[model samples]
Target: MSPSLEKILSEIEQLTPEEQLTVMGHLVERVKKHITQVQPKRKWSDLKSMAPYPLLGEDAQEWVSRTRKFADEHREGLQREE
Candidate 1:
């Protein structure tokens, strides 16, 4: 639709069928590399789906609560020290 895209398509069309196929393979590899790069970002969602999280059940909740309490109790002291 755009001039740049149309120009690229025109050039690609000028190539022989075999050349086009080779170029297509290179593009596919580049796309696969991009997908692999983005895979790590799904780790948080994956953690929820995977069984046996590092911390689990009541222990995790209690740890979170205790951490919150500690943060709250020392809030003024921590802020002043910083």
Candidate 2:
């Protein structure tokens, strides 16, 4: 987990039992708020839209560099094949 999330959890643990419950309630509310704030704004990948090029700019450069490093086994070179 992130350091900030860990810190929040630590603070909740240090609170009295009643305060811990309140903290948990607040955390749940904040998480729900975050879900609402983020869910609709998220942009999932579109393979069809991404079909023309899977890489661009720095990503493209990285892809090319990694591809060159693969040598013979380019397709599965970077992956853990079954």
Worst 10 residues of 2 by lDDT: 38-47
**Candidate 2, superposed: residue stretches over 4 Å from native:** 31-82
Candidate 1 C-alpha lDDT tens digits along 1-82: 9999999889999999999999899999999988776443555765675666544655777898999999997997888898
Question: How much is the lDDT of residue 41 in candidate 2?
Answer: 50
lDDT by residue (1-82, candidate 2, tens digit) is 9999899888878889999888779889989986776444545664357645544545777877887877657656557565
Model 1 bad stretches (over 4 Å): 38-82
State which candidate has the highest lDDT: 1
Against the reference, the lDDT scores of all candidates come to 0.84, 0.74
**How far is 26's C-alpha from truth in model 2 (Å)?**
2.0
Best by TM-score: 1
Give model 1's TM-score versus the native structure: 0.44
* Count of steric clashes across candidates, in order: 0, 0
Q: lDDT, candidate 2, residue 62? A: 85
Q: Evaluate residue 51 in candidate 1 and report its C-alpha lDDT on the 0 to 100 scale.
A: 64
Query: Cα RMSD (Å) per model?
Result: 12.0, 12.7
